[model samples]
Target chain A: AQSVAQPEDQVNVAEGNPLTVKCTYSVSGNPYLFWYVQYPNRGLQFLLKYITGDNLVKGSYGFEAEFNKSQTSFHLKKPSALVSDSALYFCAGGTHTDKLIFGTGTRLQVFP
Target chain B: AAGVIQSPRHLIKEKRETATLKCYPIPRHDTVYWYQQGPGQDPQFLISFYEKMQSDKGSIPDRFSAQQFSDYHSELNMSSLELGDSALYFCASSLVQGANTIYFGEGSWLTVV
Candidate 1:
């Protein structure tokens, strides 16, 4: 079975500073990795995905993720943080079984 | 065009009562999925339907059931609700079952007393 792990329960960052949210996965064959952001009382919004192309995949809201096959990691990153970026983030893996396995999720807090 | 839509944004139910949540998928989408989200946790897959047929279910109790109708809509029903069942439920739809992006609705908040 495919699964994902998010080591951090929460991440605190200052506005204008770089931020990173870590994620790792285990899957059979190739893995389709995705990142999503969720605000309070809202459903998840798609951020980015890594299917097979470049190691670094860019996504919405000036966010990007680096897919590292050796580390089994796909860490979401941003050059600078904003107070608006505070939210809960989730990492997921897509398998050939047509199901998505998600990590426990990480909450981000950006302070000005 | 509007994204996936879920009805009855908030619900409060008593134990042993039944609750039903509705969803309207995007036009032409063929697959619908249901997920449960607890406080401070990622959404957990509950069930998936494609072409109006049940496809996959995650680690959930039998009290949780779902159905897809005509590929454009779906419903999640819970019987004999428990306190542990209180959480936000989200409905999502994808163009296909495999290797496709799934879009989600705002979600419905279910509170069991």
Candidate 2:
């Protein structure tokens, strides 16, 4: 079965420091990975996605994710964390234009 | 820059009652999807429609049914609401033929008492 995992329940980082939220996925055929963020009681906002080509994909709000095929990982990263950046992050895998299987989600807290 | 729009941002219903949530996909989008998210839980796909036809289905319960209109908007009709049915129901849309990236709405917050 296709599944996604976020090993860390929470990730803490200081403001202006780099942040990484780990994600790994298991799937068959070509892999399509995506990152989404959600604020308290708010709908999810798209971050980025990886279908093919480059391993590194940049997305909205100064966020980027690295798609490591061999590692079966697509980790979300930000060069400098911000207090406002703190939110719940989810990693998902799916075929293009299909239902996505999501990870358990990781709460990212950036301290000021 | 129009995004998917949902109606009745909040709702409260009694057990066994019914509630309807509506969604208006971004213009030109041909696919609509419904999802349910409990408190602190990830969104789970319920159903999807393409060009007014059912495209895919997921973990949707028997108490819930959805359909897309000729205008491209969709509605999720939930019956026999249970306490566990209280959740945020989200409607998302995508072109499917081109972008393929699904865009979501603000979601309808349903509280069953």
Residue-level lDDT tens digits of model 2 in B30-109: 99999999998889989999999999999999999999999999999999999999999999898888867878899999
Error of 1 at A50 (Å): 1.4
- Per-residue lDDT tens digits of candidate 1, residues A1-112? 6789999999999999999999999988889888999988788898988888899999999999999999999999999999999999999998643668889999999999
Model 2 segments more than 4 A misplaced: none
Give TM-scores for every candidate, taking all chains together and pairing residue i with residue i. Answer: 0.95, 0.98
Off by over 4 Å in 1: B97-99
- On lDDT, the candidate that comes out on top is 2
lDDT of each: 0.89, 0.93
Computed on C-alpha atoms, the DockQ of candidate 1 is 0.70
Report the Cα lDDT for candidate 2.
0.93
lDDT by residue (A1-112, candidate 2, tens digit) is 8899999999999999999999999988888899999999898888998988999999999999999989999999999999999999999888876778889999999999
Q: For candidate 1, what's the TM-score of chain A, rounded to 2 decimals?
A: 0.97
Question: What digit string (tens of lDDT, one per residue) describes model 1 on residues B1-26?
Answer: 77999989999999999999999997
Which candidate achieves the best TM-score against the true structure?
A: 2
- Candidate 1 scores an fnat of 0.65
